[model samples]
Structures are given as C-alpha cells and as structure tokens.
Target: MSSVANWSCTATATIWRSLGKDETGDPLGYTEPEQILCDYEGGLSKKLASLGAEIVVKNTVWTEFALAATGDYLLIGSSTEPDPVVAGADEVRQVIRYGDTFERVADDYAILTGI
Candidate 1:
C-alpha cells in the first residue's frame, strides 16, 4: 500500500452512528465531528462495476472516510461548504471495501483507503 504522503487532499466530515433507539425508537445521539482524510475517489463507480452494472458516472464525489464503524451516517463537506453530502451505512461500507488496511486506533477501529 502507498504511504499517507501519496494522498493528494483531505476533507472533514461528521459521523453519526446509531447507539440503539430510545424508548420511543428514536436514535440516541451522534458523536462529535471528527476530521478524516478524503483520499480516494471513484469508489461509487468501482462498487457499481463490481456489481456488473454499466452506468455512467457523472460528477459524483465518492470520498473515503477512514473512521470507525461506530458511525452509520457520513456527511462529507467542510465548514465553509454550503451543504454536505450525507452517506448511509451501505454506501460507506461499499467505499470501505477499497480500503488498504484495517486496524485498531486507540479505542476505535479505522479503515485506511486510497493511495
């Protein structure tokens, strides 16, 4: 696998994982926002191709989030950006398949993808 120096750019995102539901079946809460590297691209297309689909990929931004699986929601954007793109668990998981390595970092797990 390539080193971190190979990564071109980076972005910040927010992760929201479900910690089960409350008595009313509502999600508990979301963890504080954490900054991670958005080093990869074309992940969505790669996943579709793996499924044998021939769809045209437009200006889609399939960034890589190497955070722990503890989160179920991933919002890609910077504080300056007007809006953030939210990704569900399945979408994030698909991108994670292209990760380079999986290891434990501190008290959480991390998946490093891209060059």
Candidate 2:
C-alpha cells in the first residue's frame, strides 16, 4: 500500500504488457544495448559535466582489441559535492549484442527484441 509497492505493481504490469502481444501485433522489448564510454578524452564524464550533471566516478575496466572498439559505459552515481547546477548522478549501463546494429534496431523495436 506504499509508494514503493505501487511502483512495483506498476512496473510489473508494464513488464507484462511489454512482454505480451499488442493490438498492432508487435512484440515489446529493449533495443540493443551499447557500451557506455568513460575515462577517455571527451567522454561521458565531460559530456555530463557540460550538461551540469554531478556524477561520481565508479568502476572502470580496461579492455583490449577484438572487444575494445566500444568503450565501457561509465557507471556514475549522484554527486555529494556542493553544486546547485549539478543534478543527481544518473545510472548508465553498457551492452553490446553479437550481431545487429543498436541504432537500426532501436528505430524499430518490432524488428528486434532484447534488453
């Protein structure tokens, strides 16, 4: 009967709906996930800062070729630093599919389905 409970129920319903069939006969799913790039020149950190976002630098992993083309998505959290313009840290996730372009797939979720 609390907000959390309500949110959970809502989320569950949404999930079911997303998984279920729609009137248009299209399946619901997430597009391809892309890796979050961070710790590099002109990376997500700088972008977020430019956007007036205060983020805490979290885990950083070093990857090599054959899988390093895409950088890791920087996991950032709300900043505790004092800054009026800076907003809370937002979570970012990184993912790469074996095949298929995340962009094209995103443009058409009915074409591809996976979170």
What is candidate 2's CA lDDT for residue 73?
18
Give the winner by lDDT. 1
lDDT of 2 by residue, 1-115 (tens): 3232223222110001123336896544322332321221113332234568654433222211122211211213322333212322222222223322332321111111111
Runs with alpha carbons beyond 4 Å of true place in candidate 2: 1-48, 65-115
Task: Point to the candidate with the largest TM-score.
Answer: 1
Candidate 1: residue pairs that collide: none
lDDT by residue for model 1 (1-115), tens: 1344234335444444445568997756555444454433334333244669653422122334444452244454433222222232121232232444443322212332211
Candidate 2 local accuracy as lDDT? 0.24
Write down the lDDT of every candidate, Cα atoms only. Answer: 0.38, 0.24
